[model samples]
Target: MSFGFFNIPAPVNEPVKEYRPGSPEREAVKQAIATFRSQEADIPMYIGNEEIRTNQKVRLAPPHDHQHTLGYFHEGTAEHVNKAINAALSAKDAWAALPWEHRANIFLKAADLLAGPYRARINAATMLGQSKNAYQAEIDSACELIDFLRFNAKYMAEIYAQQPNSASGVWNRLEYRPLEGFVFALTPFNFTAIAGNLPAAPAMLGNTIVWKPAYTQVLSANVFMEVLKEAGLPDGVINLIYVDGPVAGDIIFNHADFAGIHFTGSTKVFQTIWGEIGANIHKYKSYPRIVGETGGKDFVLVHETADADEVAVGLVRGAFEYQGQKCSAASRAYIPSNLWSAVESKVKQFLSEVKMGGVEDFTNFVNAVIDERAFKKISAYIDEAKKSDQVEIVAGGNYDGSKGYFIEPTVIKVQDPAYRTMCEEIFGPVLSVYVYEPSYFDSIIKTVDQTSEYALTGSIFAKDRYIIERVSKALENAAGNFYINDKPTGAVVGQQPFGGARASGTNDKAGSALNLYRWLSARTIKETYVPPRHFGYPFLEAE
Candidate 1:
C-alpha cells in the first residue's frame, strides 16, 4: 500500500474482533488489539447534483488503533454553491407536492439500499476517514440512521396523519401542509447521520433540500446520496453539495424561495445566520424556519455516592469518542471531593489501555484529527493549558502531526473552577476535571450556569433519587438533553429529541414530531353544507 508520499508496508493479517449485540466494546480494549492499517478511503467532492471523485490527498479514515498516511480534500469554488441552490429551488414545488406516503416509501427504499449494497463501503469509509472503531462505525453508519428512518416513517404514519374530530353542524377540517420552499441543510462532520438524515427530515415532508455536508465527512454524505438515488429518488428532490459555509450562506440567504437552515455547528455561526435572517425578514414571501444544534460544553456531575467505575468509563468515552468532536461529547467532569481520588484512579486505569495510531490499524485508540487546522487548533489549546498555573495536565498530553492530525486524549485537573479550561468550549479531546464538596452542590450548579456559554448536552451520575432530581432541576439551563447515570452522547432518535437551548442550538429535535412540525405550515380549510344548492356566507346571496 504505497501512497507516494512515503514508503508503506504490506497489509497485515489480523482477525476482526466481533462483539455481540449485548456486549459493547470498551475504548480500553484498543490497548492490546492488533490490526492492519490503511489510509486509502476515497474522498468524493459532491458539487451541484453530481459527485466529483478524486484521489487527491484527502483525509482518510484511520483504523481504530493505528496510524495512517494523511490526505486532503480539494476545495470547492463559488460556482458549485450557486448550482446546488438553483437545483434545490427548481425542485422545491414538485418535492413539496410529493405525498407523505410516497416520501416515506422513498425513505424506506433508501434504508433498504443502505442495508444492502452501501453498508460495507460506508462502514469502511467511516472506519478509515473518521477513525471510528468497527462497532462505532456500524452504530453511526448503520444502526442509528436505520432507526432514524424507521422511526420517522412510523411517526409520519401515526402522528403526522392523525385526524381531529370535528363538530357535526360545522363542516370543517384542518390540514397540515409542507412549507412551500427549499430547506438548506448544513451538517457536521462528527455524524454522517446528520449529513444525510437531517436533510431528509424536511425532504420527506414534501420540501426539497440543498444540503451542504461537512468537508471531512463528504465521502459518507456522497454514499448516502448513492443509496437514495439507488432507491429511485427523483433527481433534485435532495441536492447534495460540498462548498464552504460563507458561499453557501450567500446563496441560501439571498434566494427569495429559501425556506430555512437545518444547522449543526458553531453557535457563533448560528447567531450570525439568525441575525442575517432577522435583517432580511421582510424580503421573503413567507417566514423561514431556522433549526440548529450548535456547540456544547457538556459536563458530567459525579456525586460522592456515584458509581466510580461508571463515571470513569463514561468520562473516557465522552471525552475521547471520535476524538471528542461530537456535539454531545463530555468536555467536563465535576467530581465530589470525597470521590475524586477513586474517579481519577479509574480514569487513569481506563486511559492507560488506550492506543493511538492510523485509521486502518485496529490496535490504535486515538485517531487523527480531520485536518491540519484542527490539529493546530487542538495543539495550541493543549500548549496553552500546559502553561496555565490553574490547570494540571492529568494523564495524557501527546500530539503527533508529522504524518496526520493526531492528538492524544487529554485530561486536565482544573486548579480553579473559574479557570479558562473549565469555562470554555474546547471542542477537542481536552477534558477538564473539577472537584467540589457535596454540600456545595448548589454553588457548583451556579458555577456551571455562570461559566458555560453553550449548553447542548450533559449527564449526572448518582444513585440517589433526591440528589439526581435536585441536580437535574438545578442544571435546568445546562442542556436540552440531560442524562442521569449515562453518557450524554448516543441519543436515540424517537424517544429523546436531541438539541439544546441558549447557545447550544434552537432546541429543535431532529427525527421527532417537533422537528417535523418546523418543516410544515398549518392551513385551515373550512367548508359549509346547505340543504339545497346555495351554500355561502351571509354577505353572499343564494344563487
Candidate 2:
C-alpha cells in the first residue's frame, strides 16, 4: 500500500442509549445479561497470543449481588508481570515502526466493533461484573469507551498534522516518536471506558503496553481486550495481566525498559507508584513519564439565585450516580441558606423515589458500591454523622450489606464545612451539604477552593449572571471539568476533555490531544538546501 496523508473519521461523541421501555437496546442488554448469568467464564492473563492461567484464581461476583458467581480470573505473580513486560519490549520496535495510520486503524475498528456487534455484551459484562445500572453501563462501557477510541484516533491525526514552518533555503520537518520502552497502564475499577482508554491511549500512539486492570474490573477489561484483538491489533503489542499491584510494581518499576505508566486510581496508589518510580529512577534507561488521574472530593456550589429544581436534581444525580464511584462525583456542596430548604426537600423527594437494587432491574436508579470495603468506609462516615450533633443525616442513612455492598443515597447536613466527610474523598453515594449565608458566597468559594487537595470536578449554579461570573473566576483552579449549571459528573469525551490538578492528578486531559502527547517524543529535522562552502566566510566578510 502506498503511504499518503490520511485523515481519521471526524470524531463525535457516541450517543448514549436511553434503554427506555420497549427500546431495542433495553431488550438486547437484558438478553445479554441473561446469557451472561447462565454461565461462568474463566478469564486468563494475555501475553502475546497466549492466555496464561495460573493455579491461584480470584473469584468474581457482582457488587449488587455478592452471592451470585459471575466468573473467576487467573491471578498472576511478579514473574507474570515480568513476562508481560518482556512481551511488550519484544514487539516494541516493529509495532512502533508500523505506519501511524495502521495503528490508528486498529483502534478505530475496535471502536466500531464496540459500538455495533460488541456493545450489548460489553454493557452486560459491566452491569453484571461492576454493578452499574443499564444507563451507567451504556454511558461507560458502550458510549464513552467508543468515544475515547474514535476521538483518540482523530487527535492522533491532529498531532501528526502539526509541523514546523520552514525558512527560505531550509526545509524543516517534525516527527513524533513512540516511547523508547514499554508503557504500563494501571487502570481503575470505576469506569470501563477509563479502563480501556488508559491503555488504548498509549497504545494508539504506537507505544507497546502492559495493562493491569483493577481486579474488580477484569471481566469488562477482558471483553475490551477481545474487541481489540478482533480488530487486528498485532500480537505482543499490548499485553494484559491480572496481578497484585505490588507484584507488578516490583518487577515493572525496576526494569531497565520501564518507559512510563498511564494511571487512573486512588491518590494513595498513584502516590505509591510515583514514589517507586522515583526510587528506581537510576535503574531505568530513561526518565519515566508518569501520567495519572486520582481521587477527588469534588463539590457543587449553589447560589441564592440558582434554580431550586436544577440544584436539587444536580445534587441527587451528581452525588449518587453509579453509587458515586466516579472520581468526579460531587461529595461536597455549598448551598445558600435560602436555597438549601428547597434543594434539600427536592433531593429527599428524589431519593425517596429512587430504587436501589441489582442493575438487572431497570427501574433501580442506584446500584451497589464496588465492594464491602467501600460500603463499610462510607457507612462509618454516616454512622459518625448520626452520632454527632454537628451534622444531621437529612436523608437516606440506611445500609444493607447482607446480600451486597449497598448504601442508600446519603446526604449529611453539616454545621462545620470542614468536617471530614466534607473534605475527604468518600468515593461513594454520600454528599455533605453545608448551608451558608448568601453574603458569604465569596468566602465559601475561597473555602471550597482550599478545602481539599483535590480539584477534579465541581459545579456552580446561579441565575444571577454576576454571581456566575464571580464564582467561576473565584473557583478557577477548583476543578478540571468545571460545570456551569449542570452536575459535576458526566464529563463527556472530546467536548469536556477530562482531568484535574494538585492531588487529583497530573491533569493530562484525556480524550484530547494533550494526553496523546504524553506517549510520544518529538524530533525536529532541519535541512539546509543551500550550504556555505566556506564555514566562516559570510561572517568574516560582513565584519
Candidate 3:
C-alpha cells in the first residue's frame, strides 16, 4: 500500500561556468562541436513513438557559417500535425494517471543529464547552430535549461502540496490535473533553453506536447530531444516536428483537444496566433491556455549622478551582448546632458575594442545576428539612420553578410527622443541613445516611459538614492524587469522570474511556478463525513 506522500528536493539555480580559454568546459564544447560538425544529422518528426519522414526537407546551417550544412530536417504538413495531436490525446490517459512524483523524476533526470554528460554536446550544438559564443551557449543550453528543468520539478511538487483547508466533518482536496488535451510549443531561434523548456515544462505536469522549433534552431532542438529521450521520458509525451507555422496552427488550433500553446517569439506572430485562437474559441473542447513571452524594445536610462564608467559598461554589455538579440537587451538609452560626454566616450571606447565575427573564435565578444532575414532587417534600420540628419552613428555602423550575418555593434545618438529606433523593437546590436537635459530628469523619464510599445526590461543607473526612488516609482509600469545599476539582460531563472506585460505577451513568468500553472487545470473536491437526513437548513427550522 502507498502510505507516504512524496517530496522533491528544493530547487536552486544552476551555476554558469566561465568557459575561459583552455578551460576544461571550453575544451569540451569545442571538441563536441568538431565531433558533431563532421557528421550530418537527419532529424524527423516523432509522433506516437513513430519517426515520420517526409519528402519536404530543410537544411540546418549555422548562422555564423551559413554555407556549412550541419544537417537536414524533414518538414511536417497539416496531416502530420493532426497525427501529433492524436498521439498526445492517445497518450493523455496513462501519462496523467501516473503519479506526480514519477513525472517530476523524469524532468529531474533530464536536468542531471544536461548538467553532466550531455552538457558539452548541447552547448556545442547551440554554439554551432545558433551562432552563440561558448559562454552564451553555456548559459542558454546548459545552465538555464538545467535550472528550468530542476526548478520546475520542485515547483510542481510545491503546487501539488497546496491544499484547501478542511472544515469540521469535511475533507477538502484539490487535484492539479493536466490540461484536458494537447499543448503546442512554438519556440524561438534565440534561446535553446527556451526551446527546450517550452515543451519539457508542460510534460513534467503530465501534459503532452506538439513542439515546433524554429527551422534555424533544429540542430540544437534535435540534441534537446536526445537528452529528453535518454532521460527516460516516455514516447509520445512530446512530439517534435519541423513544420510551417500556418499549417501547424490551422490543424492544432481547430482540434477539439487543443489545450494550450507555449510560445516565445515576435509580437506580430503572437498576435496573429492569438486572434486565430479567439476566432476558433468555440471549436475547442476546453478553453485553451495561452501563455507567451514575445518581443521587447528594452531600454537603459542614465541619470546625471550615475558613474560614467558604470553607465558605459551597462550600455555596452546590455545593448550588444549576444549581438543585442535578447528580448531584454537594451536597444535604447536615455542619458542626461551632465553625464553624456563622459558616458559617450567610455561607450565608444568599449565598442571600438569589442570584436564581432564568427562564434568559433573564443575571444570575439560580439557575434553574428541569427540569419539573413535578421541581418537585412537590422541593416535596413542602419541605412535609414545614415540618411537621416536627425541621428548620428557614433560607433560601429557598418554591416556585411558575405561571410556571416555580421553587423557592427552600432550606437545611434538621436537628436529626437521619439526616433524610430527608440520606439521600434529592432532585435539587433543597434542602440539608439537620446541625450536629455540634466535638469529635465522628470520629463525625460516620462518620455522614456511613453516611447516604447514594449514593457519587457529597462534599467536606471543613478547614485542619488532620492532620484532612484523617484524614477523607480515614476516609471514602474514601463518595464517588467526593472533594474538599478545593472544591465537589463542576463536574468537568472530562480532569482528573477522573467516576462513582461503590454506588448510583451502574457506576463506569466516562465521560470516560476506561475508558468507551470498554465499547463494545469485545478479541481476542488470537498467530502463530508456527516450527512444531514433532511433537506431543511438549521436556520429555516429555527424560524
Clashing pairs in 2: none
Q: Give the TM-score of candidate 1.
A: 0.86
TM-score winner, 1 or 2:
2
* TM value for model 2: 0.99
Which tens-of-lDDT digit does each residue in 1-543 have in candidate 3?
575677788887888899887789888988898987899988888888898889998888887788888888899888888888888888889999988888888889989999999999999888888889988888899999999999999889899999999989999999999999999999998999999999999999999999999988888899889888888888889999888999998888888889999999999999999999999999999999999999999988888889999999999989988899999999999998888899889998998798877877888998889999999999999999999999999998999898888999999999998989999999999999999888888888899889988889999999999988998999888888899999999988888999998899899998899999999999999999988998997688653
For candidate 2, give the lDDT of residue 500: 98
Estimated TM-score for each candidate = 0.86, 0.99, 0.98
**Stretches > 4 Å off in candidate 2:** none
lDDT of 1 by residue, 261-283 (tens): 88888889889999988888887
Compared with the true structure, model 3 gives a TM-score of 0.98
Backbone atom clashes (below 3 Å) for every candidate: 24, 0, 0
- Candidate 3 residue 106 Cα shift, in angstroms, is 0.7
> Which candidate has the highest lDDT of all?
2
Where is model 2 poorest over a 10-residue stretch in terms of lDDT?
Answer: 534-543
- Give the whole-model CA lDDT for all candidates, comma-separated: 0.74, 0.93, 0.90
- In model 1, the worst 10-residue window by lDDT is 5-14
